[model samples]
Target: MSNQLFIPPNYKPVLNTTRTEKAIKLTKDLFENQLSAELRLRRVTAPLFVLKGTGINDDLNGTERPVSFPIKCMQETRAEIVHSLAKWKRWNLKKLQITEGFGLYTDMNAIRPDEDLDNIHSLYVDQWDWERVITPEERNLKFLKRVVRKIYSVMKRTEYLLYEEYPELVPQLPDNITFIQAQDLQDQYPGLNSKEKEDRAAKEFGAIFVIGIGGALANGEKHDGRAPDYDDWTTPSEGNYKGLNGDIVVWNNVLQRSFELSSMGIRVDAPALLKQLAIANSEDRAKLMWHQMLLNGELPQTIGGGIGQSRLCMFFLRKAHIGEVQSSIWPESVIEVCEKNNIPLF
Candidate 1:
């Protein structure tokens, strides 16, 4: 990954007194308003922590664990910081009695152990996670495209607003976001790596919603890794192998460049969930308390995903490094380079 296109240069990030402030404030506000309008999302309360040993936690790529700390004076128990509300949102949808087409969004913060933190990646995670129910009829490609169009509309609106308020911020966003499958991307550029494919797609399409993730592709390779329990790679009620098809929420992330802002997909139902769990070799989790409920059909059939708040901020704000938006510790080499470049770590 280090040898990829993101090698840091001897460049310094200049700080403007007002641009940073205005960019962050306006972008966040627009995100809140846009997502709500697109998905009919409502702001709601979310948990800061969850009890240890309860399956009310997220398994990020099936590798990272939640940040855990012992409750004061509590024995044999600890609370875990949420990685994301991927599972919790579905549960909440049912608990809150949310009807179809109506969903909830919450500010989610988490810690990832294995992230290679850099300009786009960060240790301190913050995102907007949302989920809504869909009937069997509404689960096809058409509905997904409609929802993606709605999301892109809000993004375009926000971009226009940003340009209106700050003339310096210029982004050439297409009125309609592009649609493509992962395998199609692979066929278009067979020699390019996964990251390279993303770069090409974003650069070519301006805005795109890549689908068919989570499941392996025609070349027997998956474009990206996703937790099996969250998505259905297999079609419902068919013993046949289910193909991968998911909706991405992406756009021109940088001022003049394109990149993904979010990767969201419709979740899997019972049998497919069980199949994915087995494939991930995480069938052991199925024995856990919460997993038992889901296995027993006690959970809702819903679609959900996370949208990175800082990533979006960084992309739209046209910042070179993620540190420009949030405060966090960096390596000595990074610090020295950042200082030389006059890039504010905060």
Candidate 2:
């Protein structure tokens, strides 16, 4: 099924194209400054792709094929565009000798060719991928929740500043974030599917952090699929809590649906890595250079995640389609539908 789109009746953009560009820049700058300062992170440059066999690339959901090509100048060695820098950040943390408190954030650009063309899903992905060095004692659920709250606080701050700058834009985000485990959501709505459950929660809560994702719930199904190598999804979190990783979802008033803005969690350690790799049936990946370093205790204990740049712009700006915030290709059918509905597509 194609991704759904809905434009509220009597809706109009708070800012036109030129003002939209200005708003996007302001949002990026304010959020990055807030997030980096809140997390003690420094900005850095990042690679667009890496060597194929390095195991540094994010294997999102363990199924999506990466966009890869042979480097002619490198004697046919292949390079794969990263889906995310979940692993590379940890290695870089170690390389840079970033102490136990500081971290690094970078603007990561990627091409996900297999992505579905829709209001939310796009072939081009731009995000702020960040990682922070932490002590081994800080890998527990409490620490994860604390970090999540910090990130959410930055988001809320950005929302306020955005509304202040563009008075015509009404603030949609709540002052606080609601936290719930994925299993609890499933239990609450036994008849509904996972996406439905998320939508229901977002509608009810306005802003929510669905915890315990990536692993099997009581129903023998995952709330959502997460990669085994980066996030410690299988690890238990204080009683029934399943994953330390979760997505930040909010109810989009314009689209009238659940919208995901970020995915973050603590990085996997040696034991978690081994167990996850075994469960994924990809133990051969353990021999990869990055995995070997991880298994050998060379990388630092860290927490990291990606915040979608255009997605944030779309949400805070109250746009119906993602193309209104970022430039990317759309199918003829999609273009026709969007045009017919008076949806703006850049």
Candidate 3:
């Protein structure tokens, strides 16, 4: 068995597979409507793939290779399955003329072939990818916190609705979320690794927003990796923070670990983009078409993020394995282990 797979001792699912399916639908509907209403987002159709070389695909963590193939038509033009709509949404904000304070949301599906499969990580990824237009003046930490609170409120509401529908599943989220910077978290737990720090914070606070990701911390290491093109990770924010992006992590009672639900931040302006690109040693990306558009001020200032759909469902339903909620291929050993443990895999 993979050492990463941790099956909670004496684990049992709250909802059976049949009932879990129904709850999944309800969970998605409740969360989607609440999130759209909370964020002023409109549901929109999104592409499964984009023409390669446009620089529209998100290079998550500046690593993982995208699943790409060539089209049979149009002289075999190469196309890449979108990693996420991070860049495409901003471009669409301009194409669709999305005004400030309004945004777009889509059901984003992706395949991360290189993902290290575990209980949480899967090759088939699904999320609610959302982006919103913002004014240049509203690109600081305060604005970011306000948006985070709004999203967390939606989460709390969704959990309440879930409880109303399924009495077996009780809501466990706290009334409010705590915010902390990567530097402070590092200082608090000087001996722990990034994941360990997150576990400690989540256990203490129930929920936390780990700010200042994608940049070097005081220890000369990053709390996490973020692609430079989409999020403004090098921007000077409150205090000694160097990034405007962060992740939402909550303590998972079922899994007994910190569970990350979303990664979000304000999109980069021309200066921030250039600075991040230079810092990442990826200055050549500035010449891409999408980069050129942003550099030339053709895209809107925006804040956007991807919230894991299956991750939320798994957490809400108290499923020990993510595959219980989402359909995906699992290794033989994992399947055997889950089966032996009475953990259903869809």
The TM-score measured for candidate 1 stands at: 0.89
Output candidate 2 Cα RMSD: 1.3
* Candidate 2 lDDT by residue in tens digits, 4-35: 54556766676788999999999999999999
The C-alpha stretches of model 1 lying farther than 4 A from their native spots are 1-17, 236-258
* Model 3 regions more than 4 Å off: none
Using TM-score, give the best candidate's number: 3
Q: List the residue pairs that clash in candidate 1.
A: 12-341, 212-244, 212-246
Which order, best to worst by TM-score?
3, 2, 1
Preferred candidate (lDDT higher): 1 or 2: 2
Q: What alpha-carbon RMSD in Å does predicted model 1 have with respect to the real structure?
A: 3.1
- Give per-residue CA lDDT, model 1, range 258-319, as digits (tens): 45677676676777778888888888777876677778877776666777788777766667
Worst 10 residues of 2 by lDDT: 1-10
Position 142, candidate 2: lDDT: 91
Estimated TM-score per prediction?
0.89, 0.97, 0.99
Report the C-alpha displacement of residue 266, candidate 2, in angstroms: 0.7
lDDT of 2 at 281: 87
Report lDDT (Cα) of residue 211, candidate 2.
86
Q: TM-score of the candidate numbered 2? A: 0.97
Lowest-sum lDDT 10-residue window in model 3: 1-10
Instruction: Report the number of the highest-lDDT candidate.
Output: 3
lDDT of 3 by residue, 1-346 (tens): 4567889998888999999999999999999999999999999999999989989999998789999998898789999998999999999989999899999999999999999999899999999999999999999999999999999999999999999989988999999999999999999999999999999999999999999999999889999999989998888888777889899999999889999999999989999989989999999999999999999999999999999999999999999989999999999999999988879999
